[model samples]
Target: MTAGRVVLIRAVNVGGAKLPMARLREIAAELGAADVSTYIASGNLLCTPPDDPDAFDRALEQAISDEFGYFREVISRTPAELSQALTDYPFGEAPSGHIYFLTGEPSAEAASDFCSRDFGNGERLQVIGRDLHIDYPAGAGTTKITAAGIAKGLGVTGTGRNLRTTAKLIELAE
Candidate 1:
């Protein structure tokens, strides 16, 4: 059976880094990724990865850097893992929330420390495994819990998807 995975590319098509979705899809296909499809323009990709997930991740990263000269972090998660993250989300029903999936496991202490930090404006955060659920009652645009801040606090790399995008990605994975 082909193993499907979601790949999130960070810092792409933003600032001066231009990674067009069409080029990304073509590159993935050339790298032997099957059924490659991209969601939106923020670098969310769904595909059947090569046999080795770790090797594929590294090769994809290298290919992007080599091809586009844009060295952004790439994070991947299986559909099952993303589904569990959605199931385990603790904030009941939040209309405005984001899920940040980490590339590496953060230390328990780091997670706890990050959770305990005060990110005012009705911001709530919960860390489960490598997934961090953040609800911003005051809107994420104005919130202080940015990707850079999260990486700095947790000592890990991650890419975030808003609730709607998260749900859509899950659906596409299925």
Candidate 2:
């Protein structure tokens, strides 16, 4: 049976790195991903994986790099994971926020150390599993805590999605 998943593509369609959403969907379909759909222009895909989730992730990542010549980090999450993430949000109401999913698992000490550090500019962080929930009241664009910064601080690479986008992706996955 096919399972639903959300594929998060890192660092594409920005800063002159363009990967069209239509092309992305096509690639997923070519890789036997059924019910392929995209959320925004930022490479969020909702698809039914024909194989194991991890294998599909690696294949999709490889296909994108081979066809588009852009090596982007691709991560996938099941619908259940997305639901749990929403339930685990650890901040007060915010004007804007993002959820960053780490590419690699971080040690408990590393996660704690990263969360303990001050990311000033009114940014709050919490590590839940490999996911980091951050709230930036002012705006994420101006925050000192960026994807790269989080990676450096926690020793794990990650890709982030705005709260709205993330919610929509979960809805689509469902």
Candidate 2 lDDT over residue span 1-174, tens digit each: 234988898989998778999999898988889988888798888899888878888998899889878788889898888778877888855658778988877888988888888767777888989899888887887777767778788898879987777777887777
Candidate 2 Cα errors over 4 Å, as ranges: 1-3
For each predicted model, how many residue pairs clash, with residues at least 3 apart or on different chains? 0, 0
Q: Give the lowest summed-lDDT range of ten residues in model 2.
A: 86-95
Candidate with the greatest lDDT versus the true structure: 1
Alpha-carbon deviation at 87 in model 2, angstroms: 0.8
Whole-model lDDT values for every prediction: 0.86, 0.83
What is the Cα-based TM-score of model 2? 0.93
**TM-scores for the candidates:** 0.94, 0.93
What is the RMSD of candidate 1?
A: 1.6
In candidate 1 the C-alpha lDDT for residue 116 amounts to 87
